[model samples]
Target chain A: MAVRDPAMTDVARLAGVSHQTVSRVLNGHPNVREQTRLRVQAAIAELGYRPNRAARALVTGRSQVIGVVAQNTTLYGPASLLAALEQTAAESGFAVSVGSVRDLDHRSISAVVERHLAHRVAGIVVIAPVESAGEALERLPKDVPLVTVDGDPHRPMPLVTVDQAAGARAATQHLLDAGHRTVWHVSGPSDWFDSAGRIEGWREALTSAGAEIPPLVPADWSAAAGYRCGQMLARMPDVTAVFTANDHLALGVLRALHEHGRRVPDDISVVGFDDVPEAAYFIPPLTTVRPDFGAVARASLEMLLTQIESVSGGALRETIAPTLVARRSVAPPPRR
Target chain B: MAVRDPAMTDVARLAGVSHQTVSRVLNGHPNVREQTRLRVQAAIAELGYRPNRAARALVTGRSQVIGVVAQNTTLYGPASLLAALEQTAAESGFAVSVGSVRDLDHRSISAVVERHLAHRVAGIVVIAPVESAGEALERLPKDVPLVTVDGDPHRPMPLVTVDQAAGARAATQHLLDAGHRTVWHVSGPSDWFDSAGRIEGWREALTSAGAEIPPLVPADWSAAAGYRCGQMLARMPDVTAVFTANDHLALGVLRALHEHGRRVPDDISVVGFDDVPEAAYFIPPLTTVRPDFGAVARASLEMLLTQIESVSGGALRETIAPTLVARRSVAPPPRR
Candidate 1:
């Protein structure tokens, strides 16, 4: 009779260690010493023992899948960030399973987490775009390795985010240097940290320049909102310059200005954030702040994986800076 | 002993069938007779024989994981389709593992597929953006359950794609009906079905109307390419109408038209496809065709899953239509 092919048992016997030790080596558990791991590996190679993932998963009760809860519907930041994270995760030999939460309510966020947990995922990355999601993530059990991207830094959970405030400041500063008196603002939704950061940065830039900060108008991150705000700004005799929270809104502002018969740069100078792909093609080619979303995503994925590696482990919060890209959108304030 | 969990042996014993027969019944193999399979199933329930997925995988050599090979870059159609597939796959209790092939070269594409095979995935979905990817996928194993989204239908693999030609036809016909003498075309990379389809539709529309068919310029799906093409068209006194393959190009076209002191609609009318979110914000809001990517994704997932179910031992192919969204981009040709 042909000799039975070597299994984990044969490798364990050859290495003079328990079958569980070989399993640990296969799973890359850090507790095993280097010598023991090498011996197990050599024995496995000699015995032709291939550890089956499904079998190991059954025994160890840990699925290799990582869940990503994102709110990427119709928003540029969230969508781009999620895509970056997916790419980063794929490079690290892990699969990111995504779930979309329409709203950041506690129930919705928590439910999404629970669904991933039911699948026995290794960890989770939450792309929390709303204020409620941060609070909900804090309410979850700390045992699971969790990292929140674009989340509030003040929140207790580990966070990886772009420096929204800095980007906003840069946008405001660009307008100031271009000889704008005061930069009128068209902001995104009120509850998002990103929105708040831009508002704060805009206020800071104005205060530092000794320019009177005008009231900020809030829009729902849509072009129509920016257009309405633009129309309103166009009517104001003293409103010579404006800053928008995102490019889409800036596009709307441009349309509103055109409708009100005011030309871009020549009539009312403008600046927007999120150098979206279409920004460079905006009628006057928008001048905007481009966030280093890829860097932020890579950093976030590394942070999450670190925590996942130390599953019963912890990680530090990281904040990355956004960059500014100058274009044709801004100009000197017209003589008032 | 935890009651030994009623292994397959117990069911086989009760049903007076071989253990392989019980395995075949559980895996839904077609070779099993209806009466005998029913007997084994009844015995399984009576004996409470729960087949361990891991052990069963070892015997049957199948993994439940579904591999989704997609492009890492940003594009509206592929990105939206992927998001929809993720949502649908989650609901069906299957894990979708993503592999991003930055290029569609045979080696790169096959390497991604091999990575999936290494994980023992049950099937794969290749979002073949370039024609080269479809060619690469053809080289993959025939036994693997595979579905191609927006790929060439010439290949024997099951396919799910949006009606690009139909949508393009609508775009071109709309511009022609608006009383344009001839419509100039700016296309995406020729290898993409979308690019080819849009070009073909535009040519067919112009031919049928007895309008002059202009030369086709290839673009890489960026606003910059469209802008370059737009700049050239702006100088032509007779270039009264244009149809671009995608929205990003239309944006560039609009900017180019504006830069050359030519006004939109009043000088030259433009129509774009994809109806990307920011399209409506274009100086004259883009009028384009919107591919129902989500519906296509849902249909693709369902079709692939049906094939898997039927082949592995359950359904049929499903196709969906694309729609057109009209906006301000197109208008009557300017009077001489």
Candidate 2:
């Protein structure tokens, strides 16, 4: 029988490793162990498997495409970040391949990462913000150039994040400075890292001021959730100031306040996070904290490209600061 | 020397054709002419070359991953549709590879499509909504199974879209039914296919009702653009009812009305389209038309998958109807 072309599987079998390991070695992924690299090299030599891209990549040193694994692409925060990432990466002469995951489970993330690997992506920028990201991230091939945006900082990976806690603190402090007795907060889902940061920041501000802390109210980062919280807060006589985790929720609160005969800033002052495009148009014009997603994406892309070229991961923990935009939504609390 | 794997160039030399012709045959892409296919087949037979994925694909006939080419993913409509597409495709057992283009130019779209072809995606779903999409889509490899979501119907590809004209007409008719003499419109960028459809719908409603058609005020789907138009309308005493292309524009119009001391329903009535989650929470609550984006996503996925399984394309021109959600924003015009 005529000899058939040696496939990636053949090289893997000769090297006594998985096909993924062969792919990793061929792609010059930095995370592969020295011993496994030699074994894969020996196998490639013996089998004479001349992968098409391998030769070109040997001269070029890296692929032009980078992969982004983003979760919740429908949400404004994630979507805007993704767009920014793409734009910045393109400016750096790299095309982006995105695989959006519905869940942050280990298997799903692994599968998506593997798909990008198969495409010979030079690096990965994961944008999943759930608490489970650390575990999921650990499962990736160690040699892959990886940087995460909006992941837990406690993890060992390089991270680029928005200072959610700081923004929340500023919002709460702004309310308290306006001389409110206390600031009530409507938070996002507790599992979200952003939510955790915002909650901590709000708590820290309240504690520092010696203001009475209100019971925690949770929302799912939806306007509907904010509206529900608004209805409940409208019934409470002492609730004069409110901080929501995002602008959409603040919108719902404004509507509820309008229906409840409460004039904004006169009856209840509200501050929101995420100065989305429509923030200025909200009924009372939301006073919101703006996270610079473009800056975050640009910074994260820089780190990822650095890792792609260096072969050794570096310590890069960068945070983008959020700014507060003063609008019409804040005032001293109405007289008791 | 160890036996070397045969490269595609070797096959092309043996076949007396270009390397691209060899690749086309290997892909089972139906675009190759019969004579060229025969020559390539003979070349493969003589050279004894078999690609890794091609052999497997011939047996399995489909890839688990589908490709989506979306333009302007940062926008709410496209982002929501992408999320919906990802969820539905996953449930149906397909991973998605997305290539977002900055522009829908033929060259960019073609490059993205070619990249997906290299990844061996089962098919492609394009979500570009610009007027140029038809021409850009024509540049795609014709043999690839393609279904367009929210594209022009005149093109030769299957399309699944929301009836934009019907939705726009509904918004305008609502204002007219509220006893307005004429309904002015704040439109999205004229180049957008949705904008064109909405303009046509709005005009149709006015012509059918015998209402005087006012000049079109253009906005670029941003609140700032809408706010500028709103300021101009606020200065006109004859502007009793207004329809905005989307809810974001309506939000800005509301802001301008408030600044100009014009009450929404009492002095003027405003209606918006796209019942985004926050629309219900807009000041005075926005009355808008709700397009079932999830349904559109689901239907498009089904059609793309069906086309992938079958070689020949089927006729699928599906339109999801939008519904009007009445709220506090519209009322009978003030007595003359």
Candidate 3:
């Protein structure tokens, strides 16, 4: 019969202290007293006990943990991406450790990356949606296994992101096909790559149709901001169609239109991106874009694993296209 | 003048390799060959370079990092708590590392706790809102500084949570105050603590008023489930008031009632919980409960800090009460 390996409980018993003390001593925690540290060390030596496998993996730099850097946010797009990535990593027998940063600036991003590297994580993924994060990504050593999601398109980095422009174009063309001559847009924060890509796509679609472009309405990714912009749109009689950067914005716009006595699809039509789960329950069920977050996660992991196994980094890029879900929110403009 | 501390980049310059290689050697990463490791070590000794403050903190076990264990979910409640906690921690000059789990089962919780211990995190916070996570919390060593958020109330562990029962009672009482004989309820998943607490409060309010207790309409936390239950409620002639466990459920209920030609506040009234950002934009605008997540987070951190400073464990419990926000969704029962 094989001998059973010594456990943490055994170390606790031999050291004449609690398991937590033994853990503290092993981790070099400052709280443990000198006497307790000596006792735990003696016990560890006596039993030939080793710390947990994860600690051992840290020493070997082969931990089955993927480090992710993400902003601490409750927004739908980034939050959905994180959840999908965690699920995908788990399915592939890897645990995810997220270093939550308050901001995506260079200093914050660099600090999180250094900590992740110190832990010797297998690979690192940074969810860089804003332009401020670009400089940090460029500064990191190119030899590290890294990938950026929803980062700058011009950056020559390994990336997997949603085709935001494609989704925007589709939403715009759908409204045009409904006999609307022009479509107004409610965009997200100006600094975000998602907002830039979406604005570009909407413009491309209108230009292709030879439709007149209206002045852009800029807003942050919040319902209150959307409502404020919606109030302005509701006062314009010629604004027959509106496409919002996200579903929450669409909800605000719908509320404003309702308050203004403008019936959806009967007076002014609306379209939104990110078909959030509650979109279908809206007063007039929302027609929106649904990005394949699961697909983006899978592609990201596959690209990362290839780099991890080969011990080389490549400038790979994959963009998943979003589909437009048709619902009651869009219709032909009412006759004058 | 003080001599500047040697940096990682300085070590790289001495080693004649990329900065990443020096990091790998310091982290004990296995990818580097013996020759490279020796060269990096020699350079480190020559330059007297210290890896970084964080790595040094790891040795002393005095890292200013708080480890948080949360399930990988996009659900509004848990997500909001996490985001708020992260913000509070950042304000207090602490970085947060989240270990995302797939389930709240005992084994999963234990594994995450062990990992946090290995990293010597200042303290651990587990966002356990399910029944299965109870046993693991009990089994942990008594000396560790730990606190649970939205965890089992029966467990003898330090915890800070939203007052779910109080919020539900307020919602029910608000409807009753509007001259409704009784209020019907659509609940969340049976196993969740939030659902159970909401049910308890609802029953208490009805019993206190000497009103008939209608059988609960069981549903999960989804607009789809709410819609299904709403369809049944709409067909019942005596249904005048409804209280749902969450805002998304209320949204679905509102949609279903609209489809059935039931005018909100005129034919039926509704109340909800969470007061999600979109609640105010819901069709008639939803009257809901707003749990102070920031307060809960601040209290949790304060309790954890107390324990860490004293190097002791206590069964501290704090529950932050939620307030009801009145909106257009509630009105006096239509004249019988």
Candidate 4:
């Protein structure tokens, strides 16, 4: 029987520090104080810890490929993030092999990660956007260079994602600033972190403004769902302003309102998120939030590269803030 | 030095039939005659042509993964196809490894294909939608079981695609049927096969009806481009009906017409393609062409599976016809 090579846990144990601290020292993260760094170095030297994956990659000249694990879907946010990441990787002279899974479940994610490891990928990025993916990320080998995008904020993992809460707050605040007494929200599926974060921000904004929080209208990320929610809201006399989770939802709301003869901005103000390319072409031209997917992609690549070149690191997090793109859809409430 | 294994071409030469016929026989296709099937089997035995990839996969129990090569894009059509393909492949108990390239050019595609080969994927699917991808598809080694989706019609390769011409004709005829004397057309980027096929169908519909052919308005697949074209069309008194290549373009056209005070279906009518999720939510729900992406994905997988289980064959094709989804965007042209 072959003996397994020494692992990151061994180094951490010898160094008298947590696994994350060991990773932080290995990654040369600036926050590691001198004493801890020296302790980690001493442990590494004593154990002959070589960070064999990176070392082997350097010797074999096979570090030009980066593995990406993402769910196969046409939804704008994940699709855009994947595209942006591929572009950024290409620009940096690396090829991307995306192991596309049917779901972000543990079994699917683990299978893809195992395949990536078999191919000797220099580093890995998992576009884990849902709650189910968090457990799998935690269970992955700690020695492997890894990063997560749009994953659980509570997980101790390297992650880069758009500030979903900030964007949602901005959208809600924009609608309230237009003199609406209170704003209603149509949110995305509950399983997604993006959805939860946006819901949080929407509630935060409403609470901060001392406005009554209306009952949440839940819908999946679809124009059809939005239209259904819109139909219900269109009949409500007090529904003066709406902030949807995304632009497609806003389009549905706009159409339902149109069919009911409720004019936009005059009768009801609307704001949306994700500022999709066609948002400006919507009936009233959607006022929406634009997350910096490019910045997030770049930051993710930088973090992954740091791990590939050195070792692992602590749960490094970078949240790119989104800007509100105010278009024609926002206005003061109707004179009742 | 190792001797090269006998390839499919060798078997084709041994048998007096075309490469495609040999493939048809090996796949147990009903079209192959009994005599031809016997001859191909005899040739296979004589040449010791084992279809080594599939045989090895069987022996090693490693045929559960399918490799897919697609460009990284957020565009609706290609993205939908990719998603559907992954879903279909998953249903068949196969994992999908996507090789995402920046371009479908020879270098990028060839590199990805090589990676897939190294991984010993059961079969490969290339989502080649652009003209540039044609040359690379043709250049790949013939022994690999491969299929191309949305590739060039002229290429001698296994391909499965939506019938763009048929969908365009349906959209054009829908407008013509609504009493528009003639329809002005806005097309997608010229380099795409989807664009060319649409132009052909649009022209054929007009010519068949004895309607004067309007000069083509060229634009990329963007709402911004559609807005520019719509501005021009809205200014023309004779432009009563406009057909855009996709739903986003229709949205832009609608917005421009709205801005110019041209009420849709009253002053002018409009039709678009791709029946996007948000199309029905457009101010006056759009009438567009809905290509069956799921059907195309299923057909592509079936074709690839047939080839993977047998020897390489000649070009096989499957073109799924899309349907016209009528909504509020079309109406009779207004009287002068």
Fnat values, candidates in order: 0.39, 0.47, 0.38, 0.48
Summarize candidate 2's per-residue lDDT along A1-336 as a digit string, tens digits: 225446778999999999889989977899999999999999988975655333333234344568888887878899999888877886775667677787887788877776666545689999868877778898777777889887997888899999999999999999999999899999998888899899999999999999889998899799999999999988888899999999999988888888898889899999999998889888788999999999999989989888877765655889999999999999999876
Global local distance difference test of model 4: 0.84
Candidate 2: true interface contacts recovered:
0.47
lDDT of 1 by residue, B1-336 (tens): 123446678899999999999989976899999999999989987975555554544445566567888875357666677677777776785666677777788898887887676556777898886789888887776767888887775666687877777777788889889998888889999888768777887888888889888888788798999999999999999898888988899999999999899988888888888878768878888888888877887777777777777665223334466788999878898887
Clashing pairs in 3: none
Q: Is candidate 3 or candidate 4 better by DockQ?
A: 3
Chain B TM-scores, listed for every candidate in order, come to: 0.81, 0.81, 0.83, 0.80
Model 3 per-residue lDDT tens digits across residues B1-336: 225446678888888999989989987899999999999999998975655434445354445567888885688877878778777876775556676778889999887777666555678888988888888888876656789998888877898988899999999999999999999999998888889999999999999999899999999999999999999999997999999999999999999998899989888999999989889888888999999988999999989888877855554999999999999999998996
**Higher-lDDT candidate among 1 and 4?**
4
lDDT of 2 at A262: 84
Q: By TM-score, how accurate is candidate 1?
A: 0.83
> Over all chains combined, what TM-score does candidate 4 have?
0.77
Q: For candidate 2, what is the TM-score? A: 0.78
Ranking by DockQ: 1, 3, 2, 4
Determine the iRMS, in angstroms, of model 2: 6.8
Model 1 residue B261 lDDT score:
90
User: Candidate 4: misplaced stretches above 4 Å?
Assistant: A1-67, A91-95, A99-124, A139-143, B1-67, B91-95, B99-124, B136-145
Best of the candidates, TM-score: 1
